[model samples]
Target: MNQVEHVANLARLQLSREELERLSTQLSRILAYMEELNAVDTAGIPGTTSVVAGDANVLREDEVQPSLSQDQALRNAPDAVDGLFQVPQIISDR
Candidate 1:
């Protein structure tokens, strides 16, 4: 099997022969580009974390706010018991 077929199997994907061939060529080109990037020299350059210029915090302050009561919150629930929303059991005891 080719590299694309192996990768598809690992990802649990069922690709056709044509798709495998196409992906193989695309993956080869991507890897070749990565190799070319790896060959660049950056001895005196500083590493960059963000491409944006500003380092300011852009978030609002966290403050206490009034929220809905139990009845108001559970008013739109399809299933509610006591004061909480109830969901169907997903796990078995077995």
Candidate 2:
């Protein structure tokens, strides 16, 4: 089993021979580009977390405000029981 086949199995994907070959070639090119980038020298340059330069907070401060009551919140709910929104059980015991 090749790297692409192993990766496809890990991701639970069922790929044909053609797809696996194409993906393998693409992955190889990407890895080659990464290797080329690794050869570049970045000695004095500081590592950047964000491209946008700003130390100040751009968002407004959070303020406590009055919210809807339980009844109001449940008013538009499709299903409600005992002051809680009722949703269909998604998982079942096999």
Candidate 3:
């Protein structure tokens, strides 16, 4: 408990004596549980990325379709110019 409080003081945490005592017991249990996990033998298991079986692809079909006109494309712009959508000016031409 005293060691936990001292370390907490060095870490700039304001921990009371009772809080430090409770946290010290809990931290010891946590470290013991982690040590138990370290004793497992995972020898010949295949390494996997995702827990779920996934089979996704991104190979799109090579096909072209008719597109909208220039007037239809610029219909949703806040501002536009001659047959083109226009964006705001970033910096002054100083």
Candidate 4:
């Protein structure tokens, strides 16, 4: 009836006794590491928004590319009309 068990129940998980014990130990170690990191002195350091802070737009130039024709695209359609896909209407005209 620990925090791990409670969380497992909430997530609809059915962990075995051994798995629960192992996870509890692992979670404890992870929490301890976080606590150790929290004790570090970070007074004069500015918070970094991104890892690549120097480059604002790190992307390639947008180029117009040739694509498949209408016939090629609609070739796999089960039902097509006027070069477009035809599907069953969900809403009725009231």
Which candidate has the top score in lDDT? 4
For 11-83, candidate 2 gives per-residue lDDT tens digits of 9999999999999999898988889877779989888877787746587669887999999999999999999
lDDT of 3: 0.84
Please provide, for model 1 over 16-65, each residue's C-alpha lDDT reduced to its tens digit, 9 standing for 90 to 100.
99898888888888988889867789889888877778856688779878
Best by TM-score: 2
Per-model C-alpha lDDT, please? 0.87, 0.89, 0.84, 0.91
TM-score of 2: 0.44
Q: Which ranges in model 3 have alpha carbons more than 4 Å from their true place?
A: 40-94
Model 3 agreement with the true structure over 38-73: per-residue lDDT tens digits: 678878977686666574555878898789988899
- The lowest-lDDT stretch of 10 consecutive residues in candidate 1 is 52-61
TM-score of each: 0.41, 0.44, 0.36, 0.39
lDDT, candidate 4, 10-65, per-residue tens:
98999999999999999889988889877889999998878885859768778877
Query: Model 3 reaches what TM-score against the true structure?
Result: 0.36
Clashing residue pairs, backbone N/CA/C < 3 A, model 3 = none
Q: Between prediction 2 and prediction 4, which has the larger lDDT? A: 4
Q: Report residue 73 deviation for candidate 2 (angstroms).
A: 16
